[model samples]
Target chain A: MSATLEKGVNAFREVMDAPIASFFNSCVHCGLCADACLFHTETGDPKYTPIYKLEPLKKIWKQEYTLLGKLASMVGLSQPVTDAELEEWSPLVYDSCTLCGRCTVMCPVGNDITYMVRKMREGMAASGHAPAGVIEATRKTIEQGSPMGILPKTFLAQVRDQSEETGIEIPVDQAGADYLVIMSSMEIMGYPEFLGSLARIFKQAGVSWTVSSEAFEATNSGIQIGVSDIARQIVMRIVDAAEKLGVKYVISPECGHAYTALRWDGPNLIGRPYKFGVVHVLELLDQLHKAGRLKTEGKTDEPLTLHDPCQIVRRGGVVAEPRNLLNMVASDFREMEDCGSYNWCCGGGGGVSANHRAEELRFKSFQVKKRQIEGTGVGLMVTACANCRNVLEEGLEHYHMDTKMIGITELVAEYLKEDKPA
Target chain B: MSHMDLLIWARGTGLQLALGVFVAGMVLRFFEIYSLGRKPDLSTPRPGKAWAGWKTIVSRSFPHPSMAKRTYPTVVLGYIFHIGFFVALLFFAPHIRLFRETAGFGWPALPTPLVDAMALAAIIGLLMTLGYRLYHPVKRFLSNFDDYLAWTLTLLPLLTGYMAFHHLLLPYTLMLAVHILSVELLLVFLPFTKLVHVGTIFVSRWYNGDMLGHKGARL
Candidate 1:
């Protein structure tokens, strides 16, 4: 083989040899993942097909990773792809994909395209091929500990500012709180209403929850940036805080990927089952609703729709709670056509919203959401995910679609006692 | 032509064509695999995801009463098509004869009429599956050329193969090659495309079963 061919061959091996690369070895390419994918629907491009998305992974598995894959890969059963050839895969893998885990929901083979997308991004990034914004954000995350490069002291200062503005105490290293609630950094930087609604709900629920300014942010950009150990490092903030604080349960906020990390994969990342209970906001709301603790008020009588965040609704099996909570609140609640676990992605997930180059494609790629929401004329859209909230609110904003965005907590919070402008 | 000569020739033609396609097509698949580019993912652990293949089929997939609660009920419907399709594949008599001579294997075939009925049932399943892909919004969104191609890949082999075997639509011998070709195409496609689910579904169901059961959640 020529040097370039050798480089191409080496690239194939580097990808094909890893265990994560071997994970595709487990996928039998059943199209059960089709319904969960967005690009397959949005562009009608077969190459953007979810199962087809795994084709590169599959070939790697068949070629160099598995006993069978290695045999197949070595004997020219599979082709060696050049860096340029693989570069063409960047948009299909990054911009066009949300890694929302919708496809992971229905995979009869349980192949997680989200994880696969993350892995592929890692490879792309290693080759210096990631999207520009992602590369910048990743550098900031690695060097500055947050993607925004907000100093930890600055983060602490933001908490102080929030407490001043809202008169709600966001705690740090409080010794004996019963709950160590973790939230995404976006709550501090952008969407403090999530924090406000959460504080309101937590207050009503009568739980002793504290947010650690030291290790408070729950949304680990590293998780989406294709750095698992770094992702694990970022997620360790909450667990470490919970252990130190002796909090009873760690409440993960309404951010989808954050919830996925804190609630589902938290224990695994921590290298043991969690000592503290991890409760998703939806689950918390569900419990409150079941207990009749949540008194929902001001459910608009106009047509309303519920968008299930991929984390809570699909992978987390939290289909009914928020809707049930919404129905309990909103008098005229209506459902988007394919709501619940079978829903399409909101075109912004797995860090796609942060990838500036992919932003334009994000709205166009949200064809599934658009079609589902088009005929409904829903004035209000409710969801449990903060990122879903941010993305869809922005999606509607970009499209100039007439829809208002609110979280389940927004409704649940309304039923709570407001300490008037103290 | 003597019955044995006709049998040998028919058998030889089918067997040789199948082996050649299976071999040559398999090599092609491997070439594609080697040429394809992918990336490393060593950070995450691959779960052992153990399950007894036979047992999980009954609990998780076949009588998947709870799977209806899943996002894709077509998957349950899929199991029916797969089971019935395989029953026809393994038990059809003419297929038994061809494999016995060429591949050095033989299994008892169902009675001729019973096999014919099973074939019809398989065709009906193919139709039901096709109808679902066409009508359901989620399904419609998920499909591509490959998805439609899969439907045809599933339906055509059963339709033409049945006709070839039963003397229903065309003469038995001529359609047999095409039937065999479709089966061969399926074999090649199976390891390559979404059709690979034939192999992965059982293991995945097992993996899913183990994972869900561990979580005290449903598959």
Candidate 2:
């Protein structure tokens, strides 16, 4: 009856479907996913192979779903997945994996290893084997409205501060606005300038946008912790607020998984389409740029390269928009190798940043990004995700590199053109 | 049974048994998978081209440029064995004559020497594939009993056929009968082993490509 081994087994059976069945059936055991993973590449450990991490899930599929497996288990030929096995796999599933989709992309038979990892995490979390740090973050998100424990008053306080600093009235609870903007807790706490920049740019563009006090946080810790029920509740808050305000769009902040949870997984989690469209902030800026509404006065002449966030560009389909926005305000923008849909992950994504146990492994995996940025030989790196920026900043500092990380919105805001009197 | 009787059983009764199990097992497995069905995606898609799913099935046949260098050996050897097997199976004169006799139709086949050369190259390619699996640490670790079993099943028919053609180590009738029996063994195991990938690869690649394609991400 407890949320232990039985619950984990039941959850796997519930999640098993056509795609999962076929993926397991079709795997050729080529081990190509190992080379596709950063953890395996950097650590040279075979256990970190992306497909190998799904052994528990695969065993469940075989034992309960396949004919031969059923017969074998009836006679006790196959060992049942025990609590100890789940315990052993905890580090492999959470600590060593970032769900980066690199292996999914590179799989010869197209197994979508990252998708399976996300599903496997459901079993891990249900079995009480989830990392302690992620459990705390999910608890905070459910109770405090933000994974970092930022409450409504704290979010409003940051709103007030941004309004005072920008000398513009930042709208709150404004019904029937053109856009309802949501900020990640990372942005609210680490980079309040992102909100200030959005306010300034919206004021100049004459776009109607407001932040809802009820649902301003965009990041979903339920997704990070791999629980759909909690993720559904978190997404429901935004859906309710946006529908009540009758907004035209909900702008996802420059947080990678936040955008994914809202724009991609949100509707599916809720089991219906939202009245308001969900758009990434960069996509909105790119749309305004295309409409001739966004005007910039100057561009940075320093040679800079973009660090494509894994979820935003690769997983979120915001690939072209970032480049389109960066081209507008950066005069010397350069492309990094393997940029756009095939970019390496920041290694702190998919709840790894929230799990304190994964810190050392996260740092080890960041070596790939380090080598990528060092290859560009640029002192300035522009990224669209606040989480990617923070992770990149930590990695850069850890390696004693002085590459400055800036959000694309903040970069655009610095070059915003002033409104002229007609 | 006498040796001649054994050859007769393998050619007639054994072939029927193997073919029946292979077809029936494959259909049942395919049905089990397809019957699970996909859940509807309620999320709205970004504005882009539709049918990215169908496009992905074709596109994934070639490796993405970024991944090609790292996966060159597997891709190369995979193409070699697959193409070689097809050419040796479908285009050899003897196989065509068998088809013409049984199925009442046949296409023109390659010259006997050309088919012989292709079979030799394919056998070498499969050996190299096995060698790569043994030598590479990652592949060696990932390999299981099922993988080796599938490899042996696939390699046996080709090896025995080549031996019968060259008349190596045994009389022609004995080698030919062994080749037929080896092929029947492969037919029986095809649906049950990792060799099922031959049918499931397209299904998996299509599903993956379509899912990502709907999101407008390049495969």
Candidate 3:
């Protein structure tokens, strides 16, 4: 059936597995998650509390899963989740939450509030309660290869441009490469320098890396929309391309959620392990540096700080790599308070960047990042995630702060040691 | 029923029924939750997962530094009340005597003055906690009937026990019976209410720590 109330209820029932069951059971109604949430903190609205956002999902779990809840429901004592309720909750589920997962980490009971929110969005999306912008982005990701509707020709053309600009060969679909590198559309369109940087680094390191024309887009809109089926299909394209080329590793681009979708949730979403390893680009760069292949001659003189992308650093375990890589070239590197795994989200993650409806709220939530950067007192900001970079740039500009944002890989590539004569 | 008869009933039959419900309900609830069976994590684990998981059970007992700084009152009061309650429940002389009489086991207890101070502190801590729950916007918003019921049930035993010990509210037998019955009420409600957190917190924290630790995240 269509995205009806019954479909949303049924979806909640279907997804109510053990973690959700225990998470609901274990919640102590401690409002610590509210203080942990940037939305509630920034907006001063209790409704933005992470656990409160899952009221509908909790209702279904209680009614269907718990003995006392079951008894209450059978006796007609408990109120069922209504369409009106879902409608009211749609904004809380989609607009307010970036799914940055601060609350999950901060939850005293370890309730995994972000996981529940992600699961709750499954019902929200099915019931057509998901925001129109996210739904459209998902549609585009399914129809087009990228959420931004960049076709293969567009991606290839960008690759060609990057190759010409770098004066280095950018291989496309070369079989038996050591790495199959993927790029998010944001990088392709907004920051082509990432591809150029990768090309330069791979050249100097003498590494075999090729871009897959078939699966060049790394960002998964299905994940942003909270639809696992579509996310699986999106990830399969990369898995198929990487498998076909027999690459040793599939390099996730400088995108936060893209790294998460590929490195963390990809195997689970596809229900099987990949034929190749999944490594975030920063991780691969750090590996190359450790192997003594990636050599840089000098460091940037400007004072700089890093904004760790929540998904890549916090959720994906690439915490040390960025620091390792950043230390190589950033001599004046200073850390922001609450950096690394505890870093605040740039507020544009989890498809908020794509959802135009969330623009105002997104900017409001960026105040957290704004204060963080302000605390750092550094003009130059180096980050690993392109989305964080973009969001940070916007926040910087919004507040008229002259913080120059650059990709960490590009910074490292700029300082690549010159090739010596043979 | 006469007060003596009521005291006898509360001490014998009522205690048995409440303990039976408490133990059986808790076991069943725990079983249902644990047996739901988490899906096997297929992702590769980082090093020291077991250590991290166990460490998290202890570590989460303290708030994260950032959270602690922001919510010091709640955290401090929470520990005070929990420590006070456990000490009063297990280490107080009267409670130890009750346990020895009922279960044929006893342990060295704190001196009467020490236990008395701890009981008073716990009662004050619980009262502050309840007042915070009622007044604090976020806590108040998050609280439900379960939270208030759990709070009241937990507090009643300590309050009634204190009254019985000091012989303030009624005759010693009646007050003791009230204390026993309040404790029984808590036992019966323990499995059904937020009081279940006493048992489930470790499991939740361990799972969370294990999951995050597998990803190399420090909980």
Top candidate (lDDT): 2
Each model's RMSD to truth, in Å? 7.2, 1.6, 1.5
Please identify which of the two predictions, 1 or 3, would achieve the higher TM-score against the true structure: 3
lDDT of 3 by residue, A1-422 (tens): 26888888877876777667778888877788998888888898888888999999988877877789899999999999999999999889888887788887888777788878888888888888988888888888889888888999999999999999999989998999999989888899899999999999999999998998899999998887778889999999999999999999998889988987887788888888788998889988999999999999988889999998888888777888899988899788999988887788888889888888888888888888888888988888998888888888888788888889899989999999989999
lDDT of 1 by residue, B1-219 (tens): 554454455446755676576566545544443444433211222232233333444554433222344434576566667777887888878778967976798988888787777778778877887787677654565566656776777787888877877677555655675676677566555555556455445544554444333332334
Query: Chain A vs. true chain A, TM-score per candidate?
Result: 0.85, 0.98, 0.98
Please report, as a residue range, the 10-residue window in candidate 3 chain A with the lowest summed lDDT: A13-22
- lDDT by residue for model 1 over A1-422, one digit each (tens)? 12243443444445442223323534533445554567665665556666565455455555554454566676767676557755787677777777676565455555555656765655555555557776677667667766677667877776677677667777677878887766665655776666777666766667677877666677777667555566777767667778888888888787887877666666655567666787777788789768866555555566778888877666666667787787776787878776776677888887788889888778887666777788567777877777788888788887788788777776667656543575
Residue A229, model 3: Cα distance from true site in angstroms: 1.1
Candidate 1, residue A343: the lDDT equals 73
Docking class of 2: medium
Real contacts recovered, all predictions: 0.12, 0.68, 0.52
> What tens digits encode model 2's per-residue C-alpha lDDT throughout A287-321?
89889999998888999999988888887777899
Q: Indicate which candidate wins on DockQ.
A: 2
Better of 1 and 3 by lDDT: 3
Candidates' DockQ values?
Answer: 0.16, 0.74, 0.66
- How far in Å is the alpha carbon of B47 misplaced in model 1? 18
